[model samples]
Target: MLLKRIQPMAYHARRLYVELMFQVMGRALQAVSEVDETVRREARALPAGLLFEMMVMPDGPRLVVEHTGDGHFLYHGSQAPRAVDLSIQFKHIAHAFLVLSFREKTAVAFANDRMLVDGEISQAVRMTRVLNRLESFILPKLVAQRAVKEYPKELRLPEKLLSAARIYLRIVTHLFQTARTS
Candidate 1:
C-alpha cells in the first residue's frame, strides 16, 4: 500500500521534470539558430516536415521539433500528435536529465548506452552534428569543449564578439519572455 501510494507521485514528478527539460532545450535551440548562421545553414539541410524528438521511455514527457523550412524548425510542445522521423530515448529520468542538462555530451552518452536512437543512422548523425554546433555557441567554452568533437576555430576576433553579443541578447530576451508568461 505504501509503495503504491508513492509510485503515482513519483511518476508525476518525473513527468513534470521532463517537460521542463524539453522546454528549456527547445528555447535554447531557437535562440541559437536565430543568432548563428552556421546553425541556420545546417537546419536547412534537414528535410522539410521531418520530426525529431528526445524523451524518456514509455510515455514520459517528450519534446517535439518539426523542420518547417530551410534553416527553420518549430518546437511543437510535448507529445504532439505526429510521426517522428527520429526519436532518441533515455533509459530513465536521470539519463534524460543528464544528457539534456549538458553535463553529458551526446556522443559520450550514446556511446555509453545511456540513450537509444530510433530511425535512420544518417539522420541521427546529421542531427548530432547540428546539435554539436549549437552547443558550441550556447554553452560556455569550458563546458562546450567536452560537448563537441572539434570546436570551430576560424571565428575572427570581430566575428566572435558579434556572435557572442547576438547570442546573449537573444537568450536574455527569450528568458524574459518565458518568465513573464510562466
Candidate 2:
C-alpha cells in the first residue's frame, strides 16, 4: 500500500518536471531562432507556417512551435494549435522525462519504441536537427554530449557560454513579459 502511494507521488513529480522542461525548451527554441544564425537557416528550410508539436500521449504536457514566414520560430506554449504539421508524441510521461532529462537521447528513445512521430519523415528530420542544435547551445558540454548524437566541433567554449547566457536571459525575460501580460 505504501509503495503504491509513493509511486503515484513520484510519478506526479516527474510529470511536473517534464512539463517545466517542455516550457523551457519551447522558449529556448524561440530564443535560439532569433539569435542563432544556424537555427535561422534551419528554420528557413522548414515550411512557412509549419506547426510542430511535441507531447506525451494521453493528455500530458506539450510544446508547440510555429515556423514563421521570416525564417523564425514562435513558441506557442503548451496549447497545441489546430492542424499540427508534425507531431512527436512520447508513449508515456516516463519516456518524455527520460529524453528531456538527457537520460536518453531522442534517437535512442525512438529506436526503443518510446516515441511516435506523426508527420513527414523529412520534416521531422529537419526539426530534429534544429532541436539538436538548440540543445548544443543551451546545455553544458558534458550533458550535451549525452543528449546529442555528436557535439558540434565548431562551437568553441567561449561562444557556447555566451550563447547559453543569451538564450537563458531571453527565456527568463520572455517568461516575465508573458506573466505580466497574463
For each candidate in the order shown, give its overall lDDT on alpha carbons: 0.76, 0.91
TM-scores of the models, in the order given: 0.76, 0.97
Q: In angstroms, give how far residue 70 of model 2 lies from its true place.
A: 3.0
Residues 72-160, model 1: lDDT tens digits? 66667776567899998888877776676667788888888988999988877877777777667656777777778777787554775
Off by over 4 Å in 2: none
lDDT (Cα, tens digit) per residue for candidate 2, span 1-182? 89999999989999999999999999998999888898888779888999999999978999999998566888999885688999999999999999999999999999999999899988898899889999999988899999988889999999998999999998988899999999
lDDT (Cα, 0-100) at 21 in candidate 1: 69
Write out the backbone clash pairs for model 2: none
Error of 2 at 177 (Å): 1.7
* Candidate number achieving the greatest TM-score relative to the actual structure: 2
The top-ranked prediction according to lDDT is: 2
Instruction: Let me know the TM-score candidate 1 reaches against the reference structure.
Output: 0.76
Clash counts per candidate, in order, are 1, 0
What does the lDDT come to for candidate 1? Answer: 0.76
